[model samples]
Target: MKLLLLTALTMAAFAANSVLNRAAVGEAGMDALAFGVIRLASGAAALAVIVAWQRRGFAMGGVGRFVAVAGLLAYIFGFSVAYRGLDAGLGALLLFGVVQVTMFGGAVMAREAVPLARWVGAAVALAGLVWLLWPRGAVKMPVGGAVAMCIAGLGWGVYSLQGRLESDATQATAMNFMLAAPVAAVVWFLWGAEGAVTGVGLALAVVSGVITSGLGYALWYAILPTLGAARAGVAQLSVPVIAMAGGMVFLGEPVTGRFVGAAVLVIAGVLISMLGAQVWAGRVGFTKSSSGS
Candidate 1:
């Protein structure tokens, strides 16, 4: 139960990230590069405070940390810059699609066994995404932004996989954020000056870092051990749907029939992917005894 709640919260965090980033870049007119840097700095600051207050042990040199940091840099920069031409909903859909596909493909390449249900789930989710964001009636997408978002998604997928190798989620995440912040800052210095960060943009970026990306990531790392990749991926399928809904409510973006349908399919895919474990647990004698007594 605790793990499930954390999983839900983690998904909400991801959803909040999409919504908040959109607000900053789309609504506030902040350059993606500047917003990305500010977001990273804000998240690092928030995590640093938590680490200090908690006195968490953080030793900073390892290959895993380096990989994670690089991946984080790619994701942060790619994510921010990608939005220069991509719409929020479409960008998110493309991002997650690449993330999921790459991660799943990586697992396959590693000789990991994937169950039939998971494949079905992946298919359903992919099809749903296509339906939701394939540009209706000759609406042209910005090719450069689309490519950037795909690369960003791949970076994020690699990051997620790297997270699986760490022993301490909080320690690893803090280190990644702290180290990656400098790299992000450098990129910002080189590119961010072009777009001045407005007040609203700063606030949105900070909120994204402090609340959704920072603490949310801490919560995610805490839950990763218990949830594993399949469950984690399943839970994250909720993010795009939530972001679409948030876009409707907060940004006054219209929700189409295709979006609704995609939501259903993606959610169904998640449930199906987890069905085996859920069913097996239910069938185990311990579940009944524990519940009854």
Candidate 2:
């Protein structure tokens, strides 16, 4: 139950990132690049403070650190830029769909021994995502935006994979943010200045970085060991549903039948994917006991 609560909170935090980004960039007229850089910097500062408070000197030394940094930058930049042209709903769908595919593929490659039921559930959830986000009438996609979101998704997938292997979630995340901050700063100097940042936008970006992103990512890493890759991939499908609900509340967006149906499907899929593993484990244990008896 504790784990479940933590997972739910983590998903909410992830969803909040989408909401905060949209609020900052879309409504506040913040530059996408500036928002990304500010977010990264603020997240770095927040994590650094936490790490210091914990008396943990930054010691996140691993071969995966560089890869994680690269993936993190890719996700931040691509996500911000993609939102410039893509609707938030459509962007979330595309981003998470690619993330699902990437993580699932990685899980298989790592020989994680995922169950059939999990795969089926993932498919169901993905189908629901498509149904909810699919544009009506002739679809006109911004090519650059689509490609950018795909890159963002792929980056996030890789970053999540790296996080699963971390021995110290906070320390590792803090170190990554610290290292990535410099890169983000360079990007900001080069391109991010194009977008103006209002006081409201900066505050939103800081909140997003510190609360939703920094602390949220640490919590996610802490839980990743319990979830494993396959289930984690499917579990994140809930983000879009949460984001849509957030939009309605925070952005005054309308709720639609399609979203309602998709939310049900997404929840059902996540439940099946997570519970199927327990059932499978139980069945295996029962088989062993029966044979011994």
Candidate with top TM-score is 2
Q: Give me the runs in candidate 1 sitting further than 4 Å from their true place.
A: 87-90, 109-112, 139-143, 280-293
List model 1 lDDT by residue over 1-293, tens digit each.
Answer: 56666777788788888888778877888777887788888888888887877888777857878888888888887887787777765787788888887777766665555666667776776677667666656665699998989989888888877776777777777888889888888867776377868999999999988889888887777776555565566567678787878889999989788878888987777766656545544676445311110
Error of 2 at 25 (Å): 1.5
The lDDT of model 2 is 0.86
Query: Local distance difference test, per candidate?
Result: 0.76, 0.86
Residue range with the least summed lDDT across 10 consecutive positions in model 1: 284-293
- Per-candidate count of clashing residue pairs (backbone under 3 Å): 0, 0
Q: On a 0 to 100 scale, what is the lDDT of residue 40 in model 1?
A: 80
- Model 1, residue 153: what's the lDDT? 88
Native-to-model Cα distance after best TM-score fit, residue 276 in candidate 2, in Å: 1.8
Residue 220, candidate 2: Cα error in Å is 0.9
